[model samples]
Target: MTVADAAPMPAGPGEPGFAEAVHVFNSLAVPEPAAATTARTVEQVRSAIHHAARRGLAVRVHSTGHGAAAARPVRGALLIRTALDGAVEIDPRARVARVPAGTRWESVVRAAEPHGLTAAHGSSGTVGVVGYALAGGLSPYGRMVGLAANTVRAVDLVTADGRHRRVDAESDPELFWALRGGGGGFGVVTAIEFDLFPATTVITGAAYWPGALADRLLAAWLDWARDAPVIATTSVRVMNLPDFPDVPRELAGRTTFAVDGVVHADDPVSARRCADDLLGPLRAIGAPLLDSWQPDRPSAVLLAHMDPADPLPILGDHLLLDDLDAGGAARFLDVLGEGSGSPLVGAGLRQLGGAYATPSAPGGALDRLAAAYSYAGSGLAADPDAAAALRAHCATVRTALAPWDTGRVVPSFVEDFEQPQGHLDAERAAAVERVRAGVDPDGLFRQDASPTTTRQEKVP
Candidate 1:
C-alpha cells in the first residue's frame, strides 16, 4: 500500500500513546528520556537527526525495543521513535523486499507468504525487522542460509551531517560494508532492502517433557543434534512458566523441558523425513506432554518457541560455547537441570554452525559466529530484591559453564548495552570505527550511540 493509504500517526511528544511509547517490549519501566520525537515519515527522521546535531545534544534511535537494554539506554539526547508510515513492498520476480524500519516481521511475512517467499526473519514476529536485520539477525534457518545481514541489498539513512543517502554496494561500497553489521554508529536508518528465499513452508514445532526428564532429554538431544542435517535447526529449553490464563493449562506454573526444531526442505515429504530423524532420540526419554511438530507455513515456526506476546520485567545473559562431547553435555545438564533449584525463568541452548560458521561474500563487520552453540538464561526482576537475586544467579550459571565459554558475544543476543562483548576481531572492529569517524566527524553520533563501548555490567 502507498503512504496515502495508511493512517496518520502522531508526529511528536504529548500526543496520544506518547507516554506509553517510551515503554519497551521487555517491560523495564525506565524513566522517560530528556527529549522524544515520533516519526511517521523519512523526512521527519532526517529532521530529528539534523536538529539534534545542531543543538549539540546526543540522539538515541529505537523502534520496538525488543533488543533494547533492560536499563534505560535512551538518555539526555533526543529519542527518535520511528513508526514510519508505509507498507512492506515485495518484488516476486527479483526475490527482494523493501522493509520500512519501524515495521515488524509479522507484516513482512504476511506480505510475502502469498508469493511463496520469505525474508530471513528472527524467531519473534513482534520484533522490529530493521533492528534484527541490522544487528546480524540469527533466524530459525540460520544454519542453512546464514545471518540476515548476508542478504542486505540497500539501506536508506540520514547521517549526522543531515545528508539523506541511499547506499548499496555500488553506490557507496565502504558505507554499505559498515552499516550491515556495524550496528547504529553510522546514522538513523529509515528503511532497508533485502533478499528473499524461495521456500514458503517448514516442518517445525516443539516437544515437551516434565523437568524431571530434562537431563535425559538433553543428553539424547545433544547426541541427535550433532548429526542433524544443516537443513534443520533446534534448541532445548528448561522453563518455569507462570500460572496465567493466557498460558497453556498443561504448562502453566509447571517446570518443563522442551526441544524445539525446524526443517526447511524442498517438499513436504522430505521435510517430514528430516524432522522425524531429528526427533527420534528425544522420544525415547519419555512421552512428551505436548508435541506440535508438523508441516505448516514458515511463519508457524515463529510461534513454536512461545515467547511472551507482552513485555515483562526481565533481565538476561548469554554466552557462546564450542562444540562439546558427551561428558560436556552431562556437565551442562547437571548445573541447571533437576534438583538444581535454579532461579532462572528459562535457560536455553540453541544449536548453531553450518552456514553460520562460514562467511558469505562481501561479509560485513561481523560475518560469522565462531561457536557451535549459544547458552542464554534470564529471570523476572520486578523489584530491587528480585533484581539482585536474578543478577547473582546469572553469574552463578556463567561460572558453571566457564570451561567451554568462547569468550565472545553474539550481537543479537546481547540486550545489555553495558555488557562487555567482542562481536568481531580487532581488524574488522577497527575498520568499522574508521567509517564512523569519517561520516560523523563532529562526534555528534558519539553522543547519540556508541556501539563500540565494552562497558562492564553495572552493580544494580
Candidate 2:
C-alpha cells in the first residue's frame, strides 16, 4: 500500500496491510513513509524504535499536520504516528502539566482554563505541544515568561538505543538541555512536563485598520513598540485574505493592517491597565475598523491571532533581525508593505526580547532569541506556478532585508526541513554534536531522525 491508501487502515496489523495501521493528517504527495505505524502507548513506541533499529530503518514521527513542511522529503522512513491519546495531567498545586507528545494546545488550554492558569502556547491552538515547546516556543505570552522550553521540567523518551528514559535536570542533564530546544536527535519524545503561568485574566485580541494607512500605522507601531511593556507581546501583519464567508466584510478580499497581541497580569484590573497603555497610543494614530480586544477567559489568548485550525500546505521563510529603526522599518515596508507586487498571502514582524531575551537558570540548548524582531512570510500555493512565485518573493524580501538580518533563527519557526532553521551558532552546534555522540554514538538516527534536529540552515 502507498501513502494514499493508508487512511481508514485496517483495525489490526496484517489484517489487510501493516501500512494501514498508522494515521496521519497531511495529504502531501511526496515523502511517503515506508511503513506507517501507530503507537498507542509508550511500550509500542519503544518496540517501534527497536524494530527500526533491528531492520536498519529510520523512524520519522508525526501527529496532526501542524508541523507539515511543503518541502520536506520523508520518502523511505518508518513514520511513527504518536496520536497516543491522553489527557493533560495538570498538577494545580505544582502549576505544571505533563502533556502527551501527540497532544495539541487546544486541549491543553481547555485543561488549564478553569484553574486560572495558562500554558506557554504558540499562536495556533492546533500546534503540537511537544514539538512546539521543544523547539523554543515563541509564545504570545513569551515576553512575560521566557521561551516555553525554559519551563520544561522533564521529558519521557525512547532513546535511539530503544531504552525508555525519564530525563530531567537530575537524571540526564545534558540530554535534558538538548531536548529542551536543541531539536530532536537523541530520542523519541513520548511526553513532556512544563510549567504553567498564573494568569487569571488577560487582555488580548486583534485590532485591524485599513491598509491605506500602512505608512502611518507602521510608524506608530515602531515608536510604540520600544516602550511596550514586557507584560505583553505582539505582532503587526499586512494581509491579503481571500474573500470567504468566514472572513468579516471589512477584511474580506482586502489588504489590511492588524496589530494583535496579549497582555498578562496577575489580576484582571492590572491586565486592562497594561493593555490600555499599549492600545491608547496605537488608537491615536488611526482608528481601527475592527477592535476585538477585551477582557475574557484566559483561553481567549488562543484566539487573538485567529490562526486556522486545519492543516495547510504552507511555504514559509523566516529571518531574525536586529532592532528595526526608521531605516530598517522603511526597507521592510518597501517590500512587504503597500503595492510591493508581493505574492505572499501575508508578512509580519513578531516582537522578540523582554523575558525572551533574558537568560535563565539551568538554561537549555536553545535560549534567548537575541534578536529584536522575527520576520516571517508565507503563501498558500496550491499549484506549482504559485509555489515558485512564493519562493521568489521570499528571496526578494530576504535580499531587501539583508543589511539588518542577524542570520539567527529559532528552531520552532523552522517550517521547512530542506531549509534548516540553524538555531545554534557554530560552537553550540558542535557542543550539541558532542552530546549527540554520547546518546547516539553510532548515529543510529543520523539519516532521518538526526537531520530533523541537526539541520544547519545558512545565513543567506
lDDT of 1 by residue, 51-158 (tens): 776776777777887766633356566777778777899999999999878899888887898999887888788999988887788888888888888888999988
After superposition, which runs of candidate 2 have C-alpha atoms over 4 Å from their true positions? 1-30, 70-72, 267-270, 448-460
lDDT, candidate 2, at 71: 26
Q: Residue 215, candidate 1: how far off, in angstroms?
A: 1.7
- lDDT string, candidate 2, 108-217, tens digits: 88898888889889998888898889878999988888899998999998878778899999999988887877667677788899998788877889999888787888
Pairs of residues clashing in candidate 2? 31-74
Q: For model 2, where is the 10-residue window of minimal lDDT?
A: 3-12
lDDT of each: 0.77, 0.76
- Candidate 1: worst 10 consecutive residues by lDDT? 451-460
